[model samples]
Target: MLLNQLIKELITKMGDDELIIGHRNSEWTGLGPIMEEDIAFSSMAQDKIGHSWALYRILHEELGGEDPDQFAFMRSEKEFKCCHLTEMPIGSYDFSLMRHFLFDHAETVRYNSMLQSSFLPLQQLARKVRGELKYHTLHADAWIIQLCRAGEESYLKMQTALDNCFQLACGIFEAGPDDKLLADEKVYPGEEALYGQWIENIYPVLVKASLNVPERKEPVYGGRYGKHTAYLQPLLNEMGEVFRLNPEATW
Candidate 1:
């Protein structure tokens, strides 16, 4: 694949991941265990969605892609490249917290690596996203540590959530056919390398929190190639319910 093609694929996948996870986080709007948590998760949801919009804008302006809103909300299920990890519903507070911890760390590392991208647009955007992610990881780390240390009950829940999410979290690093082009061209580090850094970054926090990182296993794949779980299509339909009614209608 050409370099621009590779960049577009990588960026679109990142954008999709951010957008889906934002939606998942938003599901906690009024249902959080506490009011403060409800507000916090809602804030993070906006951040993630905004991050996705910024990335999609880069795709549109720098990579000759479609308009950001149409490309994001109007795409079919098979056109989305988000990982299965992001598609899973926010089952419980524990699951959502654990997912946030795992996924945000991966996102942090990925954007940090992108700071050095040969592609200037991505490099600039990554720097901005990386700043926002700093607060995200901070929120995640504080909660993970607090909950893990609250008591045996909280600790056990966190451990179980970690166990449940580990494999799916690994899917964030699913390798793609064009990854080498990005790696070789310095547009971004390949997923494997970013995965390693993510592990390293999160391991210390888990250790400090007295939690066990789940044992290594096969990473879920196929999302990058348009494969997704049953939940995604429904999500798209709901997300686009208003948009599809009149694509050009001004709010």
Candidate 2:
């Protein structure tokens, strides 16, 4: 495929992931475990959602006229291209922390690769995203290490969170069929290869944190191809109910 076609495909998929995950993270406002963490979570959530809005705007105007919020809140779960990782709930400090840990690492790798992409538009978007990603990773890393070094209970909890979430971790690396074209265009790395790098980047953090990684099945891909986890439906229902109810209502 031509490089522009490939970069266009890849950017669209990447935009979907960023948008949905950002929406999910925004749910953390006022819901975090404590005051400090609450501020932190909300701050990061805002950043992510802002990034999503920017990316989605590109997808909306340039790619097609898909409204950002509607494309986000109205789509069926199966139509959603987001990975399983973002679909999961914000559970305990452990679960949420693990969630952040996994995603931050993946985003770090994902953005860094795109920063050097051959696709001009993609490279520009990636450079903007790169502004916040390193800070996110550093924050997640500190929390993971802190939790791990605290003791057996913290370690166990972190382990459980990691074990449960790692399956979805692979989803970040599972692009749709157009993935190869995107890589060939240098818009982004392919899913399987990017995932290999994610493992290498994440493993040391887990090891230093004193947490044991779990055995997991091979990735069940399809999100980018329109398949979704069970969790996405309810989320969509809620996100869209009001939109549907008041499609023409001015508020």
Candidate 3:
């Protein structure tokens, strides 16, 4: 692919992940196990959505893409590049927490790698996103460790959650066709490198939490190329309903 096309694909994938996961996070608004968790997830959802908007803005202003709102809210499910992990329903609190732990750490690794991107706009966004993701990973890490150490039952549940989420989480690193091009141009590190870094970054935390990382798991892929679970279309419908009802109406 052309460099410009490659960069657009890369950022669009990043932005789609943020947007979809932001909506998934928002689903916990009133459903968290505790008041504090409710607030924390809600706040994180806002941050994720804001990050998506910023990415879309870069696409619009720098790469000649569509409006942020249109890009986020009007796209069909197949048009989105978010991973299937983001598309899955937020299951039990254990599942949600584990997913958060895995996903946010992956986000941390990706953004950190982008800190020196040849794409100046992405590099600037990475600098700003890095600080916010610190607290996100911190929150996830603390909870994982705390829950795992709480009791045998809690520990078992956490371990199970980790096992269940591991493959899906691996999908988060699914490579774009142009990933090598991006890496060669120093636009960003390729997915393979980011996957390696993500493993290193999360292994210590998993050990500290007493959770075992599942071995030899096959990654679920295809989301980067628009294939998704059945869950995603319903989510897209609900998320876009209001915007579609009045696309011309001012917020």
Candidate 4:
């Protein structure tokens, strides 16, 4: 039962992260810089939302949690455990692109590690999610490399975006008390190990793009425990507005 608590906490954080980022990505639906990017972002947003729904279902069916819709849409700000990186508003194109790159890489590594989890449900889901994330990262990498090497203006923009988002990106690896327990149980490697893997995974891409990886600093934390930015509640309010009116209604 205690192990179930650990698994529930991990998946809840993952689902919330996916839900919030999907909302952010979908904001680019009509605002993308190009038609191709517009379509790609929309597709990726759908994928993230679907991933979140699947995670919530695993929680509900296997871990004794609420229904997926209720669990995702009805949670208050304080109840969410997503990291601060995912909670921030999608800023400029460069910022959003950089975020997509950094966040997806981290997610891919984490899910890849989860392939070995002792938790059977998560292990199975991880296999499927990892397959999807391959395309997500490939898109992110192509765009990042193309833009960063395109010219001085685009290069500078990406560099600045990377600098601005680095700290927040670091926050994605925020550790929890149960991390060690989960690691010991082979639920997944601890966040710190996953964090290291993420760094290695992303470093070469940045290097190839001629973008300087920002130096490590104090990672903005607290979101995992429900401490979030001012931007999150507004996003949540908008996200839940439709559902809040009639949460019990089947859609």
Candidate 4 segments exceeding 4 Å error:
none
Which of 2 and 4 is ahead in TM-score?
4
Question: RMSD in angstroms, all models?
Answer: 1.0, 2.3, 1.0, 0.8
Query: Which runs of model 1 end up more than 4 angstroms from their true locations?
Result: none
**Residue-wise lDDT of candidate 4 within 79-179, one digit each (tens)?**
99998888888889999999999999999998999888899988899898787899999999999999988999999999999999999989888899879
Whole-model lDDT per candidate: 0.91, 0.76, 0.92, 0.93
Tens digit of per-residue lDDT, candidate 1, span 1-251:
48888888889999999999999999999999999999999999999999999999988888888989899888889889999999998998999999999999999999899888898988888877777799999999999999999999999999999999999999999998778878889988899899899999999999999887777677778898899998988888888898999998876
Clash count, predicted structure 2? 1
Error of 4 at 81 (Å): 0.6
Q: Candidate 2 — which residues are off by over 4 angstroms?
A: 1-9, 248-251
State model 3's lDDT: 0.92
**lDDT computed for candidate 2:** 0.76
lDDT of model 2 at position 222:
71
Candidate 2: tens digits of C-alpha lDDT, residues 137-178: 898999999988888888888889988788877777775667
Task: Name the candidate that leads on lDDT.
Answer: 4
Q: What is candidate 4's CA lDDT for residue 148?
A: 88
Q: Which pairs clash in the backbone of model 2?
A: 173-191
Error of 2 at 42 (Å): 1.1
Error of 4 at 38 (Å): 0.3
| lDDT minimum window of 10 residues, candidate 1 | 212-221
Better of 1 and 4 by TM-score: 4
